[model samples]
Target: MSAKRVDSTIVVVAVAAAIVGAVALLGVLGQAWMGYAPSHLLTYLPMILLPIAFALVAVALVRAALRRRQTEVGQS
Candidate 1:
């Protein structure tokens, strides 16, 4: 896919990751403070999301930098 599309996709994923992180945080806090039990999925989500998000963001940054460099080279 094109860089623009990739960037947009990353934005969407970032939003999703943020939402999931919030839910996970709520799960933890709810269990600790309110004596509410959280599902296993909610507890384990951050462990899955954080690394994936980090990798995606790293790749996107590298791709963007490469695209920018190519454009600069073409301009000159």
Candidate 2:
């Protein structure tokens, strides 16, 4: 992959991870609606996932910005 290239898949995966994390947390809190309590491990899954997801998204944003900047610079 080129230094200035940003992968849309990476961005999409990060967003999905974040959403899954948020949903997991909600599921844990809303166990009553779920009809069963989630295991502790499942409850902790979101805590472990959210930061990684956010970090990936941050990296994607920075890469996309760099790529855009390079494109603009090359055009000038």
Candidate 3:
């Protein structure tokens, strides 16, 4: 729908990804330190999610900046 809505959703997703990634990283650590074996998906989730989170945040920021510029130009 709206740019604001898209931005909000992107931010929410980014936060979720980061949280999940952190949890997965902890699982990985537990596996290494305490011999708690995680599944293949869990073991690799941090690698996937952390980068996605970073990219999503960057996209959200750029989208926000572009939207702001568009609004400013429209008002001028």
Model 3 agreement with the true structure over 1-76: per-residue lDDT tens digits = 9867988999999999999999999988888787767779888899999999999999998998887777754543
For model 1, the stretches where C-alpha displacement exceeds 4 angstroms are: 73-76
Error of 2 at 64 (Å): 1.0
RMSD of each: 2.6, 3.3, 2.6
- lDDT accuracy of residue 37 in candidate 2: 70
TM-score to true structure, per model: 0.73, 0.71, 0.83
lDDT digits (tens) for residues 1-76 of candidate 1: 9769979899679778867877786787788687777777878887788667777788778888888877765544
lDDT of 2 by residue, 38-68 (tens): 8796688799889989899888888878878
Q: Which ranges of candidate 3 are over 4 A from the true structure?
A: 36-38, 73-76
Give all candidates' CA lDDT scores: 0.78, 0.81, 0.90
Candidates sorted on lDDT, descending: 3, 2, 1
Better-scoring candidate (TM-score), 2 or 3: 3
The 10 consecutive residues of candidate 1 with the worst lDDT sum are 67-76
